[model samples]
Target: MKKVVAISIFLIVGLASVQAQKTAKMEFKSETIDYGDIKKGSDGLRVFEVKNVGDAPLIIEDVKSSCGCTVPTKPEEPILPGETGKIEVKYDTNRVGPIRKTVTVYSNSSEPVKALKIKGTVIDRESGS
Candidate 1:
């Protein structure tokens, strides 16, 4: 009687709470961006494509680069479910050497923190190699 009624109410509430909780999922087209080989002082901009596959809005909290030579920019607005966003990374092309940097992304997705990699080589214009 009373026990059965209380059990039923509890189950209903639990189910409703579960249904109200929505999560956001982040999916990247590719986790790594390869700059390839290019001459020094060339274009150093690249974009990382991200998609929100879950039912909730994806909010990017912050984006940090591993070094000062690398700059990463995150989207300002929230990405709704089933939508796409972009993170732009710019490396210092003036530096002649190998390009190996890590960019960390913080967001309200299932995986809150993600690490992206950029790799390539920068050739010296004077050397032409």
Candidate 2:
């Protein structure tokens, strides 16, 4: 009886692992983007490129910014296996000074939720000090 139970457990675990192997995966070109130094109110936009490196389709459900100053947008359609997608991030450069923000991406990929980073410095033109 013990042997039978062990076999059943092993079979279940094996099936689960097989299913996980077919799930969608997200592979980003770079997890972090550095804008370096920029003048206030300058173009504060960047794109995070990712690839669907799994056997299934990658569906990005939502993209949330850490604060109001930063905005993130995800692709409208699902990313098929071996395909690529982009996440556009727009930071408000109006607020001068150091910038460090995070964007959380929710998807159906292996990593259901992932955090992306953006950091840089914004200098005010008026302050010219």
Candidate 3:
């Protein structure tokens, strides 16, 4: 009976530790990109730097964009602790006026999911100049 109780406690503690380790912890330099002004019909690219601050390896599953006008690219391999990765986003200013977009990142870290945003105002060359 004593052995059974001790085993159960050990198992519980072990499981808790494993669960904590599975959680992801990461950091991003900037969560939002502010493109003050962009000319209409122009294209621009922004890169967001990510770092792993957890004990376990960080894996980025995928990156998604809110609209077809924006494209996102993420790392294909696992990012070990203390390592850095990049999230590349491309914005196509096909339409005029103010624009706000979002990029969602799915990863195996503690947060599992995160979002980054970009905002700017687009103006025609005649208007901007």
- Best candidate according to TM-score: 1
| lDDT by residue for model 1 (107-128), tens | 9998999999999999999888
User: In candidate 3, how many clashes are counted?
Assistant: 2
Pairs with backbone N, CA or C atoms under 3 Å apart (clashes), candidate 3: 24-109, 24-110
Give one digit per residue, the lDDT tens place, for model 3 in 1-129. Answer: 999999999999999988776554779999998877889877678899999988788999999999998899998888888899999999887677787999999998889989999999888898673
Per-model TM-score versus the true fold? 0.89, 0.83, 0.82
User: In order, what lDDT does every prediction score?
Assistant: 0.95, 0.94, 0.87
**TM-score of model 2 relative to the true fold?**
0.83
Ranked candidates (lDDT, high to low): 1, 2, 3
Give candidate 1 misplaced runs (Cα > 4 Å). 1-12
Q: Cα RMSD for candidate 3?
A: 2.7
Tens-place lDDT per residue, model 2, 1-129, is 999999999999999999877989999999999988889989999999999999999999999999999999999999999999999999999888888999999999988999999999999888752
Task: Provide C-alpha RMSD values for all models, in order.
Answer: 2.1, 4.2, 2.7
Q: Please report, as a residue range, the 10-residue window in candidate 2 with the lowest summed lDDT.
A: 120-129
Consecutive 10-residue window with the lowest summed lDDT within model 1: 16-25
